[model samples]
Target chain A: MKLLESVGRIVAISRKEIRQLRRDRLTFGMVVAIPIVQLVLFGYAINEDVRHLRAAAVDYANTQNSRLLLADAHASQVIDLVRKASSAEELEEWLRRGEIRVGIVIPADYERRLEDRKRHGRSARPLAQILVDASDPATYGSVAGLLNLPPPERPGIQPPRWRYGSAISGVSNPPPTFEARPFYNPERRSAVHIVPGLVGVILTMTMVLFTSVAIVRERERGSLELLITTPMKPVELMVGKILPYVLIGLIQVGLVLGVGALIFRVPLRATPQDTIVAALVFITASLTLGLLISTIAKTQFQAFQLTFFSFLPQMLLSGFMFPFDAMPRPAQWIAELMPLTHFLRVIRGILLRGARVVEMRHEIWPLAVFALVMLTLAAGRFRKRLD
Target chain B: MSESAEQVIRSQGLTRRFGSLVAVDHVDLEVPKASVYGFLGPNGSGKTTTIRMLCGLLEPSEGKAQVLGLEVPKEAEGLRRRVGYMTQRFSLFEDLSVFENLDFLGEIHSLKASHRRSRIDTLLERYRLADRRKQRAGTLSGGQKQRLALAAAVLHEPELLFLDEPTSAVDPENRRDFWESIFQLADEGTTVLCSTHYMEEAERCHLLAILDHGKLVANGTPQQLMDDVDATVVEIQTEDPRRVREQLAGMTGLLSLAQLGNRLRLLLHREVENPVWQVEEELDIDAGATVQVVRPNLEDVFVVVTRDEVS
Candidate 1:
């Protein structure tokens, strides 16, 4: 009976807390506005896949074969023929300046060498070099794959070799040429992985940070003393305090999901309802954790410090950026413990793979566990009397 | 001090300690039912700590306490339902309006919605806060906030009320108004235990306990305490009271000498020796000084009880 009374009292206090929060404009914006803004920006604007790799060609050979190869290079999807550099020096300049990612150099003796190789049955190959810029390793991977092709034809007699370099060798050496396929990011763009991760980070950081500071700030200002002296219990106080932030978190999820669909063309891998449920679970856990931290912290500054430390490990361990499958067994196990890690999977899965709620159960358990532990610890820490 | 069956509060050897500091020493206290009992003390005298123990908000480190006829700390939860506590600091939600603060407090006590409105209305009218019903608690002045805090504390109509310096920062007029409301509660047969430093307010109390340095030095009605320390407090009007104070420094059993405006009031241990004559004769100070004995007030009694001067 007493516990019921305590719980009832806490609820009343929590309602009062929400009323106070609504009155403060800055706090309202931080809790409600920022989450939605972050969601949209992350979901729509950050593309990770590579679309245009700048390429140039120097057609010195001028044979029909050379023209055919040039036509093939032009027709290829990976490379964009942005400029025609007539000489090696111009090609080198373009590569250095980063105007083109891939540059082609066709040798001057290309037609003569091909006719000679056909008559004598001994080939002297014309030198064709593919020079690629190696910055941004992901975009350069596709640009580098273009070199695995047949070697240029040679003259009938041993051709005069120049100090320019050894003529391209291994011609007609019959092995399948490299056929590149990207994993996780087939388009090889930056935004696909980044936007989802950004949404998680922003929601976690802002929601937890703000909610953690709320109670501690009241305590510092002498209002907590006033609150505890009344009939309110701790649980009601926590729930009432977290409700607004949870709503804001939902709004943020919607923005990020919408932007990902409309702008980045990032698809929803699951039903909207499933995504909403997962988001609600994730937000509840986050709010619970924040309230728990607030109970232990004496001041707003301490709350922030606790929140910062809490999020640092999650950011590093959650496989938002790095692949968890490749990590060590223990590290991967730890990653599964983080609520964000599970939610990130659920969010990306639904948006990317159209996974159902049943398929996302693995993610749901961690959030549920997180909520239970946090709520219990926070309730245990809050005392009714002033010390 | 032990009381009869009707006593609402009783304590024996009640004490509380924080680190090396003894905030409340072993002391016995008894408060009769339906009476206004004032715990009078200076700052750091442990009035707050004692009240917390009585309200079941704190466990006394050593001792036994009974509040509202239930053993404290052990029966704190049960006693909590019967007592309303208003702390020194105003604890209502700042963003919430006066009505909301009262409503929230009422809800915490699980008052039925049907009964809540009438109780709130009574409290609002009683505190004269009905006109400012919609104003946020934080926006109210210090006195108004204190009034609101008191109103909220009493919303459930607990049998006993504990007020810890509830009007410390309030203006004089508000303080007077607060005391009137307190007296009204006492008339309604509710026991009230309040802590305060204002001696004038102490005079208005039916009973007072004067605590100093964590020990109860004097406990009785204001008149009884004054009568116990029967002494003459003479106010002497002079141009140079400090000079007069120096002249009368160690002469015969003079208890205390304090300068008031343009006069030095000499609190004599007794008028039997006629020391005033000796002082007037010694300095030829009869012309400028006004020498007349007056009845000792509570201020004088306070000095006599607490002051430990050598001479």
Candidate 2:
């Protein structure tokens, strides 16, 4: 009978929460909107594969060989030859003015330099040099790999030199110098990496922001005082408060992953069962975080500020915006403590790497532990009185 | 009604301190079962604090409380199901419909579905909220909201109800209606401990406890408090009432002086002899004032009690 009573109380609170959620149209919209809007924004707009950078050419050679090399540069689709500079200085001026991202300065002895490099093999001066702007991140997620187009292949000059890559610092090597072939997503599409990690971002943002205000709103409106005077247990209130949002969290997962597969063509490499399990663990962790925030914050506005404060670090360090391995060791340690960091790896591993849940167990355990600890803290912090 | 009737709530030297400020100083209580007991005090007089300690929502700093034969703050979980608390602020889920609010409480009290429905139906009818059952609680008028709050508080059929200023927002007509509902609950054997700053409301209680600076200065029926007052109740009527007010304003032998239209009612401290004659001599009115030694009521009782120092 006591167990039945507990179940009844939990159901009552969950039902009340659902009714309130439906009534609040603005908050209700966030559950569906956060996933779709963020997916389309990050998936389509934020890209790593850059193309057709505005470029200028300073062909001092002014010969058949230089013209053929310019044609090859345009053909690679990495640079568009917009302006023809009279000198290398003019090309440098265009690059600094931001009118152009890449500049091709073919030397005056282009043909002679090519033959000289062919004769000298590794020791000769390069025939061409491509200068690129590497200051901004948009430019930095770059044209580095694609700009290495071979300098106009010749028929008679057996294996001509003048490779002229980034290592044009006088030291030269044989052809095919350190080419990068992408694995998993060989096309290097941003959507493939972004669409999966978006599930974590949207869940973290909405779930934490949503539940953190759950108790605080009650406290503000005075309903929590009335609620505490009832027979409902503290743990029962905590569980019931999160139960409805948990369903919302699950529906969000289906919407995000399904839309990802349909629009972005992000592949589902692992079993759906594994993905669902990971999503449930992550959803619990995020909800517990929100519940804890609700207990700490005195008002709904504070909950919002705290939610955004937590979200920034996870978005930046969870291998979402930057590669996780590239961060400094101390930053990586901070990232490891965030539940999103572990969930990001587990979700990305399952979705992109085709790894099974067993293989990702090391990452998933942290998520479970985080949920348990936060749940305990939230339950402990929620008092039944105004004090 | 009998001498051997039980006490549903009892406390001895109940104290609550928040930092250095004692919100509820040492207070003793004996609330008879099935009585409409009133807590009378001004704002910050610790009526709410004392109620919270008895309801187990707050822990007493210096003493112990027993409600429904259960020790508070330790057996608070057990006490929760048996007691109903209506806070000063309207604490119902305002976004929820009136019926839904009662339904939620019914569930929390672990009522079976059929019993819950029947109990809710009875409360809606009793509180005259049957017509506005579908209205959101936030949109309800002040009186209608209080009615719904009372209905929700009693939905579980608790043996005790803690109402903290339940009628503050209510109109006189609705407040009268609210009292009728309280009396009905008392008839059904639900002991009510209601707190209020309004003297008119306090007078309606079957028994009363007047708090002053976190201490219980007086506890008894309204008549007992009036008869046991430590001052003389004198009413002075004159044409120039302001002159009378100024004359008796700072008299050491006066406990409290209040103006009711043209009459200056004073609770004169028993330190002086023939209080009524003394007030008549002080008036010195050109229109000639009449001094009548009248019977003291709850308002005079409140003034006399609140001015006393904590013992």
Candidate 3:
């Protein structure tokens, strides 16, 4: 009888929630609109198979070998040879102005350096340096991967040591050509990597944003006074309010995954059951996060600002934009605490690597724990008292 | 708080403080069952705060309350189903149709669908909203929205109802219509506690409590409060009412003064015998002004209690 009563009240609140959502045309529109817009924007915007980096060359060597190096750099279609700086200082000035990303500075004695390397089986320094702006670390990695192309057809001459250099972005020295093998996504289609990650990102943005504002919106509208005075328990209210959103989250998952496969041709390698379980776990975690925000925020606008601020760290550090392993230990530790970080792992595992939900326990358990912790905190913060 | 079968709401030394500011201070109340008890005070007089405490929407910083025979803020869950609250604003979902709003409330109360339908029908007819059952509450006019809010509050058949400034935004005609429904509910043996700043609305209640700056200064029936008021009423008619008002503005024992057209109505301490003569002496008019003692109204009661700060 007690279980029946709880069910009845939860169902009632869910029904009311759906009715209100239906009446709000703009919010209803957003449930479908957010995913598609995020897909298109994120698909092309964060594409990491970067090409045509605007480049300037400083040829201190001014020799045939230097010209051959410049031609190869341009012909590689990795960096656009846009300008020829008369000096390295001018090249650095161009980089500072943000006009160029890759500055190929061939040292003054490029041929002699190669000859010296062959003669002594060692060189004093690298033959030349490719100065890249590492301000956005995600994009600059592709510039280092330019060595994937065949070196500029130098006959019997050993490969030139074109060292990857950094400028103006805070990194004194960045690693060279990280993760260029392209295992799961063999076509190296950025869509393959991004679509899976987009599932977590878009869900996090919509789910948390919508649920976080739920309670605060009711309080602002004064309906919360009536709601709390009802026999509705805090747990019942929380469960009921999230039901419709959970369903919406499911629809969004289907829409995003379906469109991703159909339009982007990004294959879904996970079994149906694995996909459902992982998505549901992630959806709950994200919704719980939103509820937590909703309880903490005093106004709808404040909730929105908080949601946007919350998205920033997750987007930058969650391995959705940058490589997870590449981030420093402190950043990785902070990312470990976010449910999105684990969710990105689980989703990418299921969607790209064909891992079962249970096999992804390393990632899934944290999300389940996250949902529990967030639900507890949100319920605790949602006191029945108005003040 | 003393427990009595006749009292539906009882509170002793009720207080609420917001940070360093005391919003409600040491209010003691006994609300008899099935009575239309009113709280009459100006804005920020702790009227809403007291109602919130009783309804379990706010916790009292001090004191105890027993509402619907349950200890409030402790057994507030028990009190919730037994009581109903209609906030000062129209708190029902504006995007919902009238029927949907009531249906949602009925479902939340765990009412059976058949019974929920019948209760909603009766309320729709009683509140004159039968034709508006399909209209979204946000689209309703001021009067219609007020009726819908009242109907939603009562649909679960609560034993007690609390209305916080329910009619502040309504016109006089709609306010009268709204009160008719309140009386009907009271006749059905449901207790009601209402707060209002309007004098006429306060006068219509069976009993009234006047709160000034979080303190209850008076409690009794309207007639009893007037009969037992500490001040006496005096009215003066003159050619230059402003001049008379200025002359008597700072008179000792002068509780309140108002110009009703060409007449300056005043309240003074009952100890001021022959107040008409005192006011006339202040005006110093031979035949330009006429003054006399008068009966006290609810507004006079309000002025006597709250305007003490000015003196």
Give the Å shift of residue A61 in candidate 3: 45
Writing each residue's lDDT as its tens digit, candidate 1 over B1-311 gives 54577788889999988889989998689888888998888899889999888876677889999887789777665765578889887777778899998888788778877799999998888888999899998899998898898898888888899999988989999999999999999999999989999999998888889887778878898889887775667777777777777777866767788887987777776654675665575444444776766667888887877774212
* Index of the highest-DockQ prediction: 2
Report how far off residue B239 is in candidate 3 (Å).
3.1
Angstrom error at residue B271, model 1: 10
lDDT of 2 at B304: 75
Enumerate residue pairs that collide in model 3.
A212-A294
Q: Which stretches of model 2 miss by more than 4 angstroms?
A: A44-173, A177-181, B1-5, B249-252
TM-score of chain B of each: 0.93, 0.95, 0.96
TM-score of every candidate's chain A: 0.61, 0.68, 0.67
Q: Which ranking of candidates, highest TM-score first? A: 2, 3, 1
Report the C-alpha displacement of residue A234, candidate 2, in angstroms.
Answer: 1.0
Please give the clash total of every predicted structure, in order.
23, 0, 1
State residue B26's C-alpha deviation in candidate 3, in Å: 0.8
Q: What are the candidates' individual DockQ scores?
A: 0.39, 0.63, 0.62
Q: What is every candidate's alpha-carbon RMSD to the true fold?
A: 11.1, 10.9, 11.3
Candidate 3 reaches a DockQ of 0.62
